[model samples]
Every structure is written in C-alpha cells, then in structure tokens.
Target: MFNKHGTWPMKSSLLTRNVIILSMVSFFTDVASEMLYPVMPIYLSSIGFSVLLIGILEGVAEATAGLSKGYFGKLSDNQGKRLPFVQLGYALSAISKPLLVAYVFPLWVFFARTLERLGKGLRTGARDALLSDEATAATKGRVFGFHRAMDTLGAVVGPLLALLYLAFRPEDYKMLFLLAFLPGILAIGFTFLIREKKKERPGFISKTKFFDFFRYLKESPSNYRKLLVPLLIFTVFNSSDVFLLLKLKESGLGDTLVIGMYVFFNLVYALFAYPMGSFADKWGMKRIFVFGLLVFGGVYLGMAFAEQIWVFAVLFLFYGLFSAATEGVAKAWITNISHAKDTATAIGTYTAFQSIGTLMASSLAGLIWYSLGPEYMFIISGIAALLIGLYLYFSKL
Candidate 1:
C-alpha cells in the first residue's frame, strides 16, 4: 500500500523511474565490486595471505557492514529519509575501490575492504526501502527481482572486463583496482537521479542505539520471525562465494578459468533473476525460495564429488539458478510480511544478523577447509541446505 507520489502508477509498468535509476546505481556499484572480487583471493595469496587470513578478513569486513546496516537502517527510519543515506553510502563505496591498492599491508587491505563493506551497510536498508516503497505486495517480487537482475548484470560485465584486462596483463591487480573506481563513480552519479517521497517522522522516534534494531524482532509479526529463522539458519551454512572460487583453484584450475566460471555463474544469475522473481509472484515466494535451496543443495553436493572442469561448470550453472531463485525473492518475501513503516529496519535487522551469520559461516568454513579438505566442507554445507529446504517445505509458513 506504499506509493511514492500518491496512487501507484505502476499498475501498467513496474519499472518506475526510481526503480530503474536505483537499479542502474546498483549495476554500476556491483561492476566496481565484482571487478575485484574474482581476483581478491588470488591477490591476497600473492601477497602472502593464507586461506585462514582471507577468511578472517572477509568475516571482519562483512561484520562491519552488517552491524552498520542495522544502525543506519534505524537512523533512516527515525529521520524519515532515504536519499541522503543512499548518496553517502555509494560515495563511500566509490572512493574505497582505489584505496584497495593504496598500500599492500594486510591491515590496510583489511581497512580498505571493511570500508567498502561499511558503505554497503550504510545504504542497504535505505536503498531497499526505496525499492519497497515503489512496489506493493503484489509487485515486490518483480520490482526486487528486476533490481537484482540489473545489479547482477554488472556482476557479469565486471569480471568479463577484468578477464579481458588480465588476459593482456596477467598480474596487474593494483591497476585493475584503480580502474574499478570508474564504474563506482558512475554508480554514484546515478544515485543523484533518484528522488524519494517525503515522509513524516513517526510519533515515536526510535533511539539510535547501535543495537536498537534488534528490538524489532520482538515487535515484528510472527510470520516475519518465521521466515527469518530458516533463512538465517541457511545463511550459517552458506559461506562466502570466495570459498567456491578458491575450491576451484585448489582443484587446479587456472585463474582465467576460475574467473570464467564465476562470470558464467553470474551470467546465469543475471539472466534468470527477473524470471525467477516473476515465478515467485505467480507461484509463491516461499515455494520459489525452497526450490532455490534445493538447487543450492544439489550444486554443493555435486561440488563435493566433482573433479572434472566440466563438472565444475555444470555446478556453477546450477549455482547461478540457486542465486536467482533466492536472493531478491527473499527480500520480496520479507517486505511483504514486514510492516511498511519499518521496511528499512526490518531488512537492516535481518541483514545485520545475516552478516553476523556470514562472519560465522566464512570463519567456520575456513576452519573446516583448513582442517578437512574442501570435499568435506561442501558435503556438510550441501547436507545442511537439503535438510533446511525440507523443513521449510513442510512448515506451514
């Protein structure tokens, strides 16, 4: 029932001006981020970072982003504004790219990475709230799904750009990091095109305590909690995708092929995100999400046994489907169940805990990878996903 300018003009078209512009912003930002993503692990390895250290770096960075998401999300709600947060967040992220190579010290690398993720934290709730405000319960899937598709399209272009560059100059990661800044700036520019509807502050302004966002869980409807519980549980088993790339590398694939697989996975993701969202709307968000989990279970289980390059390709293909099915669909599902006023807070709190879960997941996965081979890690994750999928399928929620 939220509409930006009064009545919803989106009955005929879901891709309103704000959604397109925001999606463009996401598209460019992702381009910047993903350009570095496929190379990060390899670059760290070249600079003497062990797998364990990499895990810790990702964990710490994500934790920073996660915690800030809650605070900033709550702040946005209190202030009844989204544009400033979105603008500032993208600006921080835009500048953080070139800083990645400003110095090669491990602490500096951690600092730069955390700064970038912090930007993500700053904007996630506000940005998503804007998207939610543009759509109704009926169209949340298409709106979010379209945004994700556009965002992930950048994921495709980014690595492909990196791959092309690396093809010419194989180890020039620093220069590549510097180049990523261009797309980031473009993303920032797109942010200016976005205009939010003015909203009055609630009668009860929430305090801006760092952990205050967590209180929403108690206040939220049962359905919100029910949906979140299984998703968060699933997140614990789902480590960073970096681990997947590293696994391919450990299996003896070269950098180019590893990155290529990543690109292909994203390509599949970009292609299917919108369609999957439409499917969620037509069928049920919960049903599509459960199906995505089943696909994820299959992909990981397949990764457990696969040794051939072709096998890995097939798995990555399915992995993309898993991403398509779940990512935006989950957000749409949450927005549907949450109170409209608390849109940003609901997502921020969920994502903050999700970030914490990611920290745990990445750290745990790293420990498992260090102790027992990747096979065991993949198997454990696969089994856990399958179990969770079944549980969700049977649950009444």
Candidate 2:
C-alpha cells in the first residue's frame, strides 16, 4: 500500500493517518473559506467598490499571504515544529470570519481579508512541510493529490451550502459569513489532533536567515532553478478567480447561478484531483503539468468567448482539471527535487514568487477590465498562458 521509503505512514493498513486527518481539516476549512470567498467580489461590488478596487484588494491580500508563507516556512525549519504555526494561523482565521458580519465597510472587509490570508500564509508552508514530512518519494503525488482533493471537496460543500443559504435567505451575506465560523473552528480543532512524528532534520538551517525563501534555491540543483522560470511566467498570466466569477455574473447569470457554477467547478476538482495525481505518478508530472497549462488556456479562452450559459458547465470543468493538475503536482515536483530539511522553504519561496505573479496579474487585469471589459482580460490571459505552456513544454520544465 506504501512505497519503499517506509515514511508518511498510513495510520491504519488502509491509508496514512496524517493524510486522512489533514484532508478532513482542509475539508472543513475550505467549506468555511469558499462559503465567503466567491461572495467577496460580489460583496465588494455591492458596497460601491469598483472592479479595479476589487482587483487591487485581491492582489494585496494574496501578496500578504505569500509573504507569510515564505517567512513562516523558514521559521518552521528553525523551530523544527509545524503544529504550533498551523494552530496559530487557524486561530487567527477562525476568529476573523464573524468580524466580517459585524463590520460591513470596505476597509473592514479589506482588513478581514488580509487578516484571514495572514493566517493562511502562516499555516500553508508549515502545513505543507509537515505533509511533505509525512510523505514518501514513492507516493508524493498521490499524497498531495489526496490532500488537494479533500480540500476541494470542502470547497464544493461550502459553495453548495452558500447557494442553499442564498436560495432561502436571498443575499443574506451576513448570515453566510457568520455560519462559516462553525467549520473554521471545527477545522482548527482537528489541527490539534494531528500527531507528527519527529524526523531527522538538517540543523544547518538554523544558521541561515529567517526570511530567506530563495536561500535554499541557490544551493539547489540547476534543474530546480530552471524549472521555476515557466512556473512564474504562467502564474503572472493567472490573475484572481474573483474576476472570472465576476465575469460569469456579468454574462447575465444571476448571483445564485454564479455560485452554482463555483460549486460545479469544485466538484469536478474534487473528483479529478486524486486521479490526476495518481496519473502523474504513472505517466509523469511534467507532461500533466504542461497539459494543465494548455487546459487553462482553453478554459480561459472558452470563458472569454462563451455565447451561452451551457458553455459554463464545460469550461468550469476544464478549470477544475487545470487546478487538479497543477497545484498538487507542482508541489510534488518541487518536493522531489528538494532536500528533506528545507521542503517548507522551497515550497514557500515558490508560493511567494507565484503570489507576486498573482499580484501583478490581478492589478493588470483590473486595469484591463476597467478599460476593455472582462472579454479582453481573459483573451490576454489566455494567449499568455498558451505561449507559456508551449515554452514550458519545449523547455521540458
């Protein structure tokens, strides 16, 4: 059932305990996070914030989270502990949900978004490192894929819940925000229950700087550094999903239908995530990743030119395929090249640069959308992705 590494043990004979628990935690957390996430752009629009402002808000929030991922990643290495950072991060996010309901200003929403992302940044690196710690080289793809599938499954549930609540309450965004608190707390409690095994660590990290995400990269192999080029390029083309969802609403789908589309996207994501990961293991991650980038291009292009609402069901599924292929697979690829001691830092640095790309993309998309509309934004992003995906394939990254 496991690889030869004898690592990242399955708690039972069936699967790893850490994976199962972490998946559960992610499920509950996503359930909470996605419940409010899709609505965020809509909420901002309702509060008289311009599309440009929404783009800026998304960019800033993600950039902040990216910073946290990098910093806390190194901190986790120095402390040789992952659980505490995860716990603290979850606590910060868990408390911030209700505050959104209580305070309803753009500035308050911005603060709430940033505060919640701060928690995510802190938790993400340490948590991923912990996961990598549990994983073995033999099944890293499946392991990470399983985690993503569970996480996306929660995303599916969250949007569905939001859709149902909205169906009845009909724009009761406050109640939806308040109900999110339950799952967030539940996810946090599950974090405490995780039992991490002490593994051998390279003590050399403590002597290095705390915030240096790129420190390990200099020391990493040339192939590792080269692979980063295309990843960053593609990320720069990929802006906020908030804009994409907003695009759907702008296409004349009601707010409720837009949420339904999100739920549908997550469902496809949950379904494909594990299988795609396993496929990557057998077929090869680079091929899958390259294919995913192309799929991203197709999805974006389809959304850009979509003439009917029926097209959404298909394009959104393509979006799910792209997400399943890239996210866990990319992490698995990085983990494969990285030294055991510095997984968190490598992942964090990767995340940080990608977020930088996201910040730029969102900012640019906002400006483009403001002038030309969503169609042009998607067209530009799609063309860029297509070019980048071709480059990555040729580069063999």
Candidate 3:
C-alpha cells in the first residue's frame, strides 16, 4: 500500500520494511523506558519514600498516559501527519531519563516520571495510526503483531541490560538512568525512516478544526463500541505488572530472580505475538481475543491457587501468551472497523479506555487483596474474565 521512492520490489515485502522500522523504533524506545522503569520503584524505596507515595506516584505516572493519548491521536488525523508528534514524544521521554538520572530527589523524580507518561500518550496513538495507514486490510494483523513483537523484544533486552549494569554497578542507579538517554536518542532518530502515506480530506468536514475526541466516539460504528465494552471489562481486572512482580517478592523471591521472571515473560510474549497476529488475520480478532481472555482466566486462576515459586513461573509464561493475543491484535481490529479519517481518534479513545481500565484494575485489586487476600484478587479477576468471555462468545460479536 506504500510507495516510497520507487522502492519495494514486492508489495508484501514493503510491509516488512515499514513494520520492521517501526519495530526498531519501538525496540529502542522501550529499551530506553524499561531501563528506568524497573529502577524507579527501587530508587523510590531506597530514598525512603512510603508505599503510599509510591502508589500515588505510580498511579499518576500511568494515568497521565490517558490524558494525552486521545488528544495526540486526533491531532495526527486532523493534520494528516504522524512523524512530528512521534519524534517529539520520543524526544521528551528520552530527555526525561537524563533529567531523572541527574536529579534523584522526590520533586524532580515526580516531574520526570510524569513527563515519561506524557511522551507515551503523545506517541502511541499517532504511531499506531501510521502503522494502520501503511497496512492493507489483509496484512493488518501481521503488521501490528510484528510491531508489538519488535517493541516487546526491546522489553526483553532492556531489563537484561539494566540487570547487567546493576550487576557491575550495584548502587549506581544514576548511571543506569543516564545510559537510557542513548537508546532513547536512537529511538527518536529512527523515526526519520518511516514513510507515511497521505489521505485526502473529506469534502463535508471543515479543515480548520480537527480531533473532536468525544464526538468521534459517538459516530463510530457499533462494532467499535461493542468491542470496547468487553475490553473495558477485561482491562478493569488486568492490573499492573508491578503487582505480579510484587507477588513474587512477597513470596520471598530474590530481586534477581524477580527480574529474571519478567524477562522470561517478555520472551514468551515476543515469540508468540507475530504468530498470533497472523492467526488473527486468518481466523478473527474477536475469536482470538476471546481465546486470550480464556488464557487470562487460566493464569489468574493459577495465581489464586498456587503457593509455590515454580507455579508462579508457569503462570507468568501463560500471562505472556494472553498479552500476545490482545495488545496489537486489538489495535489491528480497530483499524479495520474504524473510519479511515477517524482511525487515529479511534486508537486514542481505545487507549484512553485501557488507561482507565488499568487504573481501576490496580486500585481495585489492591482493595480486594487488602480486604480478603492476594489470592482473592486473582480469583475475582479470573471470574470476571470467564464471564466476559462467555458473553462475547454467546453474543457472537
């Protein structure tokens, strides 16, 4: 679908080049982000921040993503350009890392962390919209899956790099944070490689104003709206990965083993994402997503019952499979069902919902854990997924 300077000897091959470039950008940026991410909670804990402060900080950091994701997404559609926002987002996030490394104080760290969320909000929707622009209907699943795979591979590499650096410089958190700047810059630089296709503005709509975030949702097809209900239900139960890591730590797992478990999870995610995406193309996104929900149900059920370390490991691996089936595959489906003009807006709305869902998931899970027990949190979450999966299947949506 993309014609970049007479390149591409084959149509299908063009998809590879574009997706791979995006993948590289995702890989490098994730490397930059994840390097600091794992370090944050530890750094805060070291500086004698309270768990309450840490919880509040984490909530603000993640929820800020919802604040801007939709706004930037709509702007991309209105302007008919994607690269500028993507580059700027990466730059802001990249710049924030060095700032965090230099100033480890509470106030400075707060701003830096919030800045990172802002960057994610700005870049994600626009970048996803661009990916959709390049892909044909037939290739959407594979393209999105490939992008997520590449993005997650960086997730795999980032923590390992952090772990290796920490192995040498155990107390040098600043150095680890500072080194993140390099990959962040590389990720921003890679944005130059993407070649975006232009679309003509519709005659009825005014060109002066763009990005009507809420109205776009009101006008979106029933499919998009229907899909959101189940997704929102699932997201409300799917809490932060931090909770999973924390569960392991509470169970007396070492820091190194905890990091290792995360790496293993990402590894499984990276391996399965592409294959799942291709399968979604052949079968359907809804069907595969239901299957993923079943996987989630199983993993959470495992978490509820398992008391052993090995059981947690097995559950973590299965959790990766659930992520592989959902993340990119959902975006690809949204791309197909949405209007061409509102594609970016649709993505923004979807992510906004996800951010809200994640916020609810974490807070509610904590409530459940405190009220009943940690095991009850996962048991309730598993049941929610099971009920929703049945709704989706019988509803035949």
Candidate 4:
C-alpha cells in the first residue's frame, strides 16, 4: 500500500496533505484554463476562421498532448524527478494562456493553444503517476476520485469567475487572460512542495528508439494487450467536449447562458465524482465504466435531436455525471493492472491511445458537422458508442 508521502505503508488517510495540495494545484490550473475555453471558439469564428480549421487545430492540440504524455512520463521516471517537469509545464501553459488573449490572430491562437496542450501533455502522466504513487491500494479509487472532484470543482468555479468578469468587462478577454496567470503561478509553487519518494531503478535503458518502447509495453504482462483492447474501443467514440459545446450553441443558447450551463455540468461532476468512485470501488470498475459509456452515447443522441436549451442543459449535466463515473476511475483501473515502476509509462500509453481516439473522433465529427450537419455527427457518435459498449459488455473485460 502507498502512503501520503508516496511510499508503501500499512495504513494511511484518504485525505492527505499532498492530495489536498495537488487538488489545489489542479483547481487553480483549471480555473486558468476554463476562463478562456468558452470564448475561444467564438473568438476564432470572430476572426474569420472556418469550422474545419477549428477542427484541425483542436485535433492537433489534443494529439500533441496525448502523444507527448508518455515520453514526458518516462523522462520523469528515468530522472527520478517530477517537480521540475510539473513546474515547467505549468509555467508554459500559464504563459500561453495570456499570449492567446494578447495576440488575437488565428495562427497565434493556434500556437498558443498548442503550447498550452503541450504543457498538459508534459504534466498529466507524471502527475497522475505521482498520485498513484501517493495512494494506498485500499483507497486508490477514492483518492483519485477526490483529485478529479477537486479538479472539476475548479472547472466549476472558473466559468463563474469568467462569467463575473465578462459581466463587468464584456469585451476585455485580454484582461481575463492576464488574470489567469496568478493561479498558474500558485500551482507551480505548490508543485515544488510535493515530496518525491525514492524507488529502485532498473538498469540503464536507451531512450532513442521509440519502437523499443512499444516492445517493452507488449512484453510486460502487467500492461499488455488484455486491458488495452477494451479501452481503445471505448475511446473511439469519445470525441472532444468541443462537440458538446458546439451542440449547445446549435441549440440557440447565448454565449453567457451556454457557459452557465457548462458551469452547471461541472457542478454536477464535482458533486458526484467521489460518491460515484466509491460506488465503483464497491461494485466494480468495469461495471461503472461501461455504464458511463452507455450514458455518453445516450447523451450524444439527445444532443442530436433535442431542440430546447433546457433539454440540452440537462443532457450536459448528465454528460458531466458520465465523466464523474469514468475519468479518474479509468486511470485507477489502469493502475490496478500495472506495476508501480511502470505506472507512468502505462498511463502514458493509455493517454496516447486516448489521444488517437480524440483525434479521430474530433476530426470526423468536424467533417460530418460541416458536410452533413450537426444532427448526423451526434447520430454517428451515438452509434459508435453503442457498438463500443456492446463490445465491452461481451468481452467481459
């Protein structure tokens, strides 16, 4: 069992200071990120960028983050360090957020978003690996769930802050971007305080050959083909949240109201995350995960046909609940199948595959939305989700 200090121990508290600190870090960072999120698409549209460009931009950003996560995670593990990378990633994202606001050009916005995603890619695997290290086996579900809850809590508060700012200074997006810097800096500081426990390193491994890394993953029973197949299927239907946001816009909701609805979604996510995780722990991870998949499919289908803003908002809330049921719990499930030493690598691999899924889904959804219209995109996504869910159910994974 892992302890609060990220070492093996017989007994430990579910709510440790490190967990709280990490939660604070996530909270602040989400606040910074969320402030810019709602307006970004509108801002791009305002600047005369097409939906296709938006699709490409979002896809590339996510793919970059997803692909790099494993590499950075491995680097952190190899160096026996996490704080420096974590701090650097946060700093880069912090700098990028303000830059996007200051430089309103479309290409500049793309670069800024890409840089921010790069920071995310750099930090996520390492950070989650650290959380796994810090959590005891018995409370892993709750600990990860709590972290996600806190993270989404930040998401909840962030939009409200943005809403408040927009209320007074509606056009000053640049100011909101500038203000985002404060929380990121605080996150960096908190990262520095996190303690890294020592672990025995295996013999020297070459980093240049990427194929060898795949071979390593394949050879390890702890993280081989068994668990990966189901996850891959599930991810194929899991597109970017941008689609859902666009669906809201399609429902004829105003920008402020759309953001308010998003805030509501995060509120539901934050409220239910821990309790759902505990329930998953009791029932089974696979069971809850499959349920989330089904819920996601149903929500997408609802988005396709729903004409009312209120209906869309409720669907969004259920979408948040779906997230609460899965995100961290899925990671916890991965950790259950992986050994401590390769925790980051396994997470990185999982994230990398997830990125592939996002890239495919987002790019496809965008094309469908532009060519066939919004209705077909959700219809296809729902169909894909149903197929994946059926596969999971039958596979019994």
**Residue pairs with backbone overlap in model 3:** none
Candidates in order: C-alpha RMSD to true structure: 3.1, 3.4, 2.6, 3.5
lDDT of the candidates, in the order given: 0.90, 0.82, 0.84, 0.78
Q: How big is the positional error of residue 279 in model 3, measured in Å on the Cα after superposition?
A: 0.6
Better of 3 and 4 by lDDT: 3
Error of 1 at 212 (Å): 0.3
lDDT, candidate 1, at 19: 89
lDDT leader: 1
Candidate 3 local lDDT, 1-397, one digit each (tens): 3355433445455355556677889999998888876787777888777889988887898878885787788777777778888888888888988887566588887898899889999898888988887778877888899888988999999998998898889978888888999999898888888767656754444443323676766888998998888888889999888778878888889988988999999999999998899988889888887888899999988887776888988999899999999899999999999988888889998998789789998899989988999899989999999899889878755
- What are the clashing pairs of model 1? none
Against the hidden true structure, what lDDT does model 4 obtain? 0.78
Candidate 3 achieves a global lDDT of: 0.84
Q: Where does candidate 1 have its weakest 10-residue lDDT segment?
A: 1-10
* Superposed Cα deviation of residue 143, candidate 4 (Å): 1.3
What local lDDT score does residue 65 receive in model 4, on the 0 to 100 scale?
Answer: 88
Q: Once all C-alphas are superposed, what RMSD does model 2 give against the true structure?
A: 3.4
* Cα lDDT of model 1 by residue, 1-397, tens digit: 3256443364447778888889999999999988987788888898899988987887788789999999899888888889999999999999999987898899998998898999999999999999999888888888999999999999999988888899899999989999999999999998998879888767876468998898888998999999899999999999989889888988899977887898899999999999899999899998999999999999998988888999999999999999999999999999899988889999999999998998789778878888997889999999999999999999988
How accurate locally is residue 132 in candidate 2, as Cα lDDT from 0 to 100? 83
CA lDDT of 297 in candidate 4?
Answer: 85
Return the number of clashes found in candidate 2: 4
User: Please, what is the TM-score per model?
Assistant: 0.93, 0.89, 0.93, 0.89
TM-score, cand. 3 vs. native: 0.93
